[model samples]
Target: MPRKRTPDAHDRILDAAGGLFDRYGVHAVGMQQIIDDLGCGKQLLYREFASKDKLVVAYLERCTQDWDRTFARALAAAATPEEQLVEVVRAVQTMVPGTRGCSLRNTHAEFPDPEHPAHQVSLEHFKAVREQLRELARRTSAADPDRLGDRIMLIIDGVYASGATLGATGTAEEAVALARDVIRIETSLPVAESEIPADVR
Candidate 1:
């Protein structure tokens, strides 16, 4: 029987898998590719990951941690909820062009089984992002935060799609502009001042 790989070996495998998953996408890359990329044996890969699906889950989990920390930290520095929203949108500008893909979106794009742990995580992340945005929108505007959050999410989805398709055509700039417009519209909306939620920003 193949010896169990050490924790270091597992970490290395995950590191390699994440890079490959990000660069080549989850569906596009395979175990052999990971093995070759990691320069680790097949036994080592299996010992660490158990199966491809398991590794996929690990990859996504890692991404979630990375994103959670990044967004949380970004939101921390902003003085207001509205400022936080603009900064977050501006932050994503760095990801536009090139592959222009979202890690969670790329992972779940071809997923047929929503029951998969990776798929579930994707759904949860999506919901979390939407809620966060909704709260931010509510804090930034006078109207219903839920409605603006939904609209912002719709535009965010479009921005992701546009980023993937726009290549080097200044899509990042365009996404920022669109997001700013959403914020502006939100500020102009009429609602009781008391309706706006406290900043979780």
Candidate 2:
């Protein structure tokens, strides 16, 4: 009879696989590598995940959850829609350093076939993120909320791409400042009292 799988076996395997996938792109890593990293029997790993594709799907789903958390944190960190949009960029900027960029993005590139589950999941995530940003942008005073949302999304994409390629010192370092400027310009927001000349005040 096959040995019973532990309650945490699936999570254990997933966690190990996620770590490896994060370090190296999904395609570069393999089941054997995950088994070695997890120190679990091959049978056990297979029992938990039918195949590598399944494992990758699970990993990407977990990554989507992580993005949700990031979005939640950004919303909680700020009061206004403009601040929240900037906070989203700040959140991504905070996360991209010293890593292999966004996991969903890397995995998306690895699986180019649109029919592939990984690719589909990545596309869904991108759509969800875009909608969330648009929702926030609509709440702001921007003349064009959709445009503002797309602009912020571009900044986020740049942050991840630059951070992964050039590290923290590259264009990634300017992300927050650029986001602030974009928000200010898009919203046509008034200057802060501190920025106003004392004589004028």
Candidate 3:
């Protein structure tokens, strides 16, 4: 009789795949690379994920779950919409210091085809974050919530794009300040220095 496989095998495959995918890329990292990294055979990897595309989707889904948890924690202490907006930026700032770049953005860049499952997952995640920004913008009474949301999203993209090149040079910190300034200007509020979170300030 065949030995029963542990559920942890699935997580181990994803963990190995996530590291490779983040370091290299979705298309560049193959199943064999993951198999080697995990010291597992092709059959075991295939048992957890039917195909490479499915593994890519799982990797992205894990990333989204992590982002959700981080965002939720960031918003927990925020008392107002503006504060929440700033917290979102702060959350990204906190997350960027040790990372190479955004995994979702990296995956989208590697696989540009819209029909790809990984690409579709990346798009949905982007849309969801943008909508969250729009909601926060509306709550802040911005003249144009959509425009504010777009601008904030642009800042986010800039942070991720420049992080690989300028992260250690304080690029992420500067981006957070820029985001705070944009929010203040759009909302027409004189945001005090003390109002800014210590980490972001």
Report the C-alpha lDDT of model 2 over 39-144, residue by residue, as the tens digit.
9999999998889998899889988898899899999999999999878888886666247888899899999999999999999999999999998999999999
Sorting all predicted structures by TM-score, with the top scorer first, yields: 2, 3, 1
TM-score for each candidate, following the candidate numbering: 0.81, 0.89, 0.88
Best by TM-score: 2
lDDT of 3 by residue, 63-169 (tens): 88988887798678699887787777767755552366888888888888999999999999999989988977888878988888888889888877787777734
Each model's lDDT: 0.74, 0.88, 0.83
Residues forming the 10-long window of minimal summed lDDT in candidate 2: 90-99
Prediction RMSDs, each to the true structure: 6.9, 2.8, 4.0
User: Judged by lDDT, which candidate is best?
Assistant: 2
Off by over 4 Å in 1: 1-7, 95-100, 189-201
Give residue 64's error in model 1 in angstroms: 1.5
Q: Which stretches of candidate 3 lie over 4 Å from their true place?
A: 1-6, 97-99, 191-201
Sliding window of 10 residues with minimal summed lDDT for model 3: 91-100
- Tell me the spans in candidate 2 whose CA falls farther than 4 Å from its real position: 1-7, 169-173, 193-201
Please provide, for model 1 over 1-201, each residue's C-alpha lDDT reduced to its tens digit, 9 standing for 90 to 100.
Answer: 867669898889998888888787788899999999989899888888889999998888777777677678758868877667666665664543247377788777767588888889888888898898887777775477787777767766766677777752366566556666666677773433553566731
